[model samples]
Target: MDIMIAAALVMRPDGRTLLVRKAGTRVFQQPGGKIDAGETAEAALCRELAEETGLRVEAGRLRGLGRFRARAANEPGRQVLADLFLLHLPDGMEIVPGAEIAEARWVDPAGAGIPLAPLTGEQILPRWVAGAFAPQQAG
Candidate 1:
């Protein structure tokens, strides 16, 4: 079965993206997670953002979609349906790294660092940074 989800492409003021290390673990990923059964993808993004980062986003235009087969990092071998968005973070919200998150860090999207969300690194993000996926294809 496919796990439906949503996530944010949260870029900081310094051009770095916000990535979270899963709590009690080392897998790095975006703040958002699986969308609840009755929730719209955008609603899920907003909800997950606040839950994971203690920040709220008004989830604007549709940004893109992330499709992949989940692997490793405790979520091995499941298919994922993710809706991605460019979000706005509330100013001054501290990163508390909630239950599912161990640490939150902002890093250069182009630089080397901890591996990002498994499928993201291999698809969306690289293409995102390279301008391969334009805003027109958001929805």
Candidate 2:
């Protein structure tokens, strides 16, 4: 079971979310990565965001999204189980795409590109659509 941890992160005042095109990834993805055993999802979230996007995310509500199973683009026939968190970072934090991240862009939830993780678009986007987008706009 590959324990993938991911986030749907919103940007302030623009109602956009952070999506990363990883160096070796074909699909754009939320700022996220895998979780080592013994690490809570929140810790993994903060660590992965830092490693993947160079931002220290402040943990918000842990939505406890259930596992998602799918064959990722390059991982044919192999399924990964992902636990996702919806996180928010400090206000005014500017992003610098990290080594694993080829490029980072703020994507309007209304117009997100094809998510690198299909299951991410399937599961995460609805939540982002319902509520996450506005908080950023309000800020």
Candidate 3:
């Protein structure tokens, strides 16, 4: 069975994106979680952002970036379908890793030099490079 999730491409003004590593996991990914039944994708994402990163973002702040499908990063023999969104974080916003998140990083998308989730490496980053979700380019 495929996992259904909501993910965020969190961007900072400095051309950095936020990625999170789960506890005991090495592959870094966009911070998000499984969408609950009867929950809107935006709503689930809002809840997930707060849970994983201590960011209280309203649903209105999430710009839908459409859906992407890829192999599950941590689960073998399973696929994942993600409803992705773009979230431009405010300046000086603090990110405190919470719940199962072990570390949060601000990375230059061009060369992170870290192991990334398949969804991030294959689907998201390519699109990001194409300026699909990024509304503003940092100089």
Candidate 4:
């Protein structure tokens, strides 16, 4: 069975992204959680981000990056289907990790020094480096 999750590629102007390590987990990934039944992806993401990082974001601010799939990071023999979004954080916004999140860090996606979840390493970072998240020009 696959887990349905809503995740974010939380970016900063410095070109680094925010990654979170859940308590007792060695691999770091985007801050998000399983989408609850009857909950929209944007709603779930907004809630999860606040719970995990104490960063309250409006759902309308999340830019859709589409769905992504990868091997589960903490779960063996399972896959995770993630509805990913891009969030460009405002300057001076502080991240205070709470809930199940053990720690949070800013890392260069191109060469993150720590271990990463399969989804973040294999799917997210490559897309990020390839400029998939670059803002499109209108007109």
Candidate 5:
């Protein structure tokens, strides 16, 4: 079965991204959760971010980063279809862990030391390191 989720690629000015470990989970992942029935992806992301990270974000502030499919991090034999977004947080915004989140941290995209969800480790990190989502240069 495929679980539909909305995830955020939360970035800081220093070029590090945020990852969270949910309570009882070993793999760190982008802060998000399953989309509720009738909810848009952006709306689901906004709600998940607030619930998991205590960061209230306006849906309009999120930029579409593309969707990714990977094996579910905590659920064996399950797939995850994630709608990802690029979210740039303002300097010094404190991220408090909420709900199921056990811990959160900022890590360099190139060599994140902790274990990561397949979606994060296999797909998202490589794209980030290659600057696939970097702002376009104007000629």
Candidate 6:
């Protein structure tokens, strides 16, 4: 079975990315959730982000990072097809874990020691580490 999800790659100024652990889940994944029927990927991501992290974001602020598929971390014999978005957040924004989120943390893309979802640990983090989606700064 394939599960469709919308995910966010939220980056900090210090080059760390945000990851969240849902309640009863050991693996941390991007802060996102399943897309509702009739919802666009960007819209779903924005809604999921706000629900999971309490961080309100405009759909326009999310840049497409491409779609990825991997074995679902929490679901047995299931694959997750994720529409990923890259978002650079302004400094000093506080994120309170909400909804299904149990905890959230900033992780160094290069050395994230905590267990991560396969989609994030394998596909997403590599792109970030290799600077495929490096943040653009206004001069």
Candidate number that wins on lDDT, 1 or 5: 5
> 1-139, model 1: which lDDT tens digit per residue?
7777786777655556788888667667766888888888888887887788887666564354544444434466776766766653445556776767888887777763787767567655676678765653232
- Measured with C-alpha atoms, the lDDT of residue 109 in candidate 5 is 88
131 Cα displacement, candidate 3 (Å): 1.9
lDDT of 6 by residue, 2-80 (tens): 8999998888988888999999989999999898999998888888888889899998888887889999999999999
* Candidate 2, lDDT over the whole model: 0.65
RMSD of each: 3.1, 3.6, 2.0, 1.9, 2.1, 1.8
Q: Model 3 reaches what TM-score against the true structure?
A: 0.94
Model 2 per-residue lDDT tens digits across residues 1-139: 4536555454545556778887877787667667778887677877888787777666654444455665664466665566665554455878888768888877777667565566557656665677644443333
RMSD over all Cα atoms, model 2: 3.6
Q: Which residue segments of model 5 deviate by more than 4 Å?
A: 136-139
TM-score of each: 0.81, 0.75, 0.94, 0.95, 0.95, 0.94
Error of 6 at 18 (Å): 0.4
Per-residue alpha-carbon lDDT of candidate 3 for residues 29-104, written as tens digits (9 for 90 to 100): 9999999999999999999999999999999888888899999999988999999988888789999999999999
Model 5's lDDT to the true fold?
A: 0.91
* Backbone collision tally, model 3: 0
Clashes of each: 1, 2, 0, 0, 0, 0
Can you tell me which runs of candidate 3 are displaced by over 4 Å? Answer: 134-139
